[model samples]
Target: MNLTQSEIDLDLGAVTMSCTTDEVATVFAGLLREMRSAAPFIRPDERDALRQIMSHESGALTAGEVFPDFARGSDAHTTLRKLRTAQFIRPAGRDCWDTGEHIEIRPFARIVWDRLGEAGVFGDPPELEEDDIDLALPGADEPVEVALPAPAKARGTRSGAKWDEGDVLDFLNDEDTQG
Candidate 1:
């Protein structure tokens, strides 16, 4: 039997699955839960630091690079160290580091996060049919017919202007025509 939502096709490396949009959102919710349980808690300051790194022009930078004003052993420095210990930031090179998988999953996580406050998995409920809608607005009297203005005529040309190759050649050969 048909359902409210159509089946969405999913392509895995070797296996494929078809599910509705609601099902996909539900799966993402499950993933979010598992990821949160496995990952360490990120404090507000640490989140700000991560935001700086993510918005960095180079896409990768050292903790010192991110918070240059914060000296070693300072609170901000300690925050960076905590992020490192949590593996939220991974070393990119000798000194440069970048966001880890947790940050990478943010795009998908955001969708789930938004849905947390919603009643459904995602998207608004299906719209009610006009016949099914019982409530009427204040202006729900006889339908008012509107008269739209006629389309404006094309500019820079006469209403019935038509030109051929001969007309073009004549125009080009006119004395007033510049080289």
Candidate 2:
């Protein structure tokens, strides 16, 4: 019947292995907040590249795959190194950071993902083949169209009720009742 603030608070970090939506959202919110505060220090070119990565459904790619477009000549390598060092865009491999390995967007990068998703970040979904589409359950080829009964006009009444305002006059006007 009663609870303290600590009791109401959920310890998401303790059970991250469970991977619940609430826990994930909490993590994302924290990351977004940190990213916002750090935005002032983050370079414009790095920001553009990060936005592209977050928008990508795969959410990752090798430096070779993403570079050249985002970073213009000489300073590109230096900029990328800075980003990697700062952990803004991280390396996929534990041993090394290179063209062969992917640089993934952080799991909490949902802000960028949502923004890009709304702006057409992902391509159209793959079309299903005719055989792949299942219209109904097994052994049921055609969908059963259910026709609902017409709505009753009477207010404050339902079907199967012993008394209905709609039929009150009929009961009152019965010959036996009148007699």
Candidate 3:
């Protein structure tokens, strides 16, 4: 298949198999890098907050540790809400969020992370614990939209039965078989 310039730039691997162009792939890698770079030393409250976000979508998180005033501040609450709306996270259950849920990291977020990873933006993997996620907020009423990479151009030959060298060979071969 003839690849367009955009496709070429994106570095789509082979024609077969599910693959994303390099451009969008890089984006997802970047997000992962960012997550890794953030020191795992997030405040105990922050860890709890993240866990809560993860739990809501996946339906249940192991309970053990206690989080302090992670959800006390208005800004923190607002930020959590926004993140949930963006589909970056969601409330898990009774005061806990699930971070590992597939939906938490939207396709767009994945693309961003991929891009960042290509750029080598992450320093080291973060040592996050289970309590990093918190899930206290009520579920969001609106649906979250995760943007996908632009569709690839359709692949095919040019219009009209133009006679190329290969076409001529095949035509002759067919004629010989008929004779």
Candidate 4:
């Protein structure tokens, strides 16, 4: 079944998840895990932005090498502002925001697109009748939304703290052992 935003919100609340830093961090870590599973490693800037994106559940495209889209802001601040107003993400630091429990990148984007399509953001499509074979297609007729790549900001270019592919893999596997 297609889960609506309201339904997602209710589910998050019911599950007792916090809309705070630790909660956001955990969710981001999870998304990173997914990315890592698919690839050797994620770029440092991408990791940071992905954390923000996942935390805020911002439907706005994320800027980075991995997920690129035209709908996102040119800078991190502007992106944060838009995300904050929408209540999708909250500020966690000077450059970070807590994505409320309700947001998940893929699912949230689908919901946003569905809502926007309903609101006529992209204009209307031809009406489909019951007999139209296209109506039974696996995916929705609406266009899939993609997160825009993050602009080449100075912060992203800064070196030293960036984690490479191997570093990320090691970090993920590192489970602190108690003596």
Candidate 5:
């Protein structure tokens, strides 16, 4: 198949949507306002514990291991219970817990980390140098000539040889064709 720059007709105008930063902020604010007022709140300590678990190579640890400050009886249980109720962490096996339902926390955290980078939380995103934007797109007026290989021939049962009625019977009787 051959195609040119001008031959490709796309309805990008209808498909594309754009908004100003202020408009995006306003919409996000409205969404936040619309959320339930009594949503569960995660404490800073719980966040720290989650980060600790995520930082661990296996993402599994005892509450005591995560929060050495607190004794492992009631206080640690309380914290783990709260996080479990919030569906953040759960029991891994005996004497240990992990992010609930064996969910991978690091990949999800990496996505958020990338979004934070894009939001300029770490620092201003690196400015694109001239070399980065030097590639030129072909204009619609310019001809884009493409040479495509001829369409492939229809294949047959024996490599490229088409089978007749006798050939089918011979193929079925041949021991080489048996499974």
Candidate 6:
């Protein structure tokens, strides 16, 4: 008889078992634990933005990295702040891997991807017997509705404690802003 995931009884009468993995998986598992606890509290777009970031090769990425020509302003600020507060993602330093030092990005994508997968959002994937069974928070069983907000029009960047888009010196090297 084929039993469904939720229906399977985990009684395991007299047998004992444990799950094991290397350092990376261990770290991932830790974050997954926190996320599972907080999943019920996570916002929709916040999850989407994080999931998009996680779907990338590197777990960390700026909102600009996720959305081209957008995500560099207030929306980015709000989304980043929300995820950070939820403890879903943490500062992984600047976007030094590619653009180098424009914005700070977070790393927690892979965990979120694995999270969405287990929700069956990706639909009926095969699972090995050794996988950890997650009794996720009830509301998490549904897919998060992602309503991506529009990017802010007036772009003003903050560097250090002060807000400055570009120095007059940096502008001198460019055309439109140049004399």
Better of 2 and 6 by lDDT: 2
Q: Work out candidate 2's RMSD over C-alphas.
A: 17.0
Instruction: For each candidate, give its TM-score against the true structure.
Output: 0.32, 0.40, 0.28, 0.21, 0.30, 0.35
Tens-place lDDT digits, model 6, residues 1-179: 22233232333579743433344456766766765665665567666776675565554455466544443346656666555665555545652222221233234534455646635322335665776775778898786644221221123433322323454434444545345
Whole-model lDDT values for every prediction: 0.51, 0.54, 0.44, 0.41, 0.46, 0.49
- Per-residue C-alpha lDDT of model 3 across residues 1-179, encoded as one tens digit per residue: 22454353333466444344565457655655555455243444554555463444333332222233234345455545545443444454444332332224344434433454412323434646887854536656555553221121112333343445655566567668779
Q: Per-residue lDDT of 1-179 in model 5, one digit per residue for the tens? A: 12233233334566855555555456544433322121135456655675566555444465556765544355656666665554344555554433232322333233433454322222334878877873556585586553221221222243444446665555456545455
Q: Can you list the residue pairs that collide in candidate 5?
A: none
Candidate 1 per-residue lDDT over residues 3-93, each given as its tens digit: 4667877787699988887787677657655545534466666667765754543324655566666565677666665655543344445
Ranking by lDDT: 2, 1, 6, 5, 3, 4
Instruction: Record all residue pairs in model 1 with backbone atoms less than 3 Å apart, i.e. clashing.
Output: none
Better of 3 and 6 by lDDT: 6
Ranked by TM-score, top first: 2, 6, 1, 5, 3, 4
Tens digits of per-residue lDDT for model 2, 60-145: 57776777434434455565665555445666675445555577655445545566351222232565797797565686865554
Question: In candidate 5, where is summed lDDT lowest over 10 consecutive residues?
Answer: 147-156
Total clashing residue pairs per candidate?
Answer: 0, 0, 54, 12, 0, 1
In candidate 3, position 174 carries an lDDT of: 60
- Give candidate 4's error at residue 36 in angstroms: 36
Candidate 4: tens digits of C-alpha lDDT, residues 52-147: 565443444334322343233445445444434433344433344333222234553334344544222223376778887674567776666532
Question: Which residue pairs clash in candidate 6?
Answer: 54-109
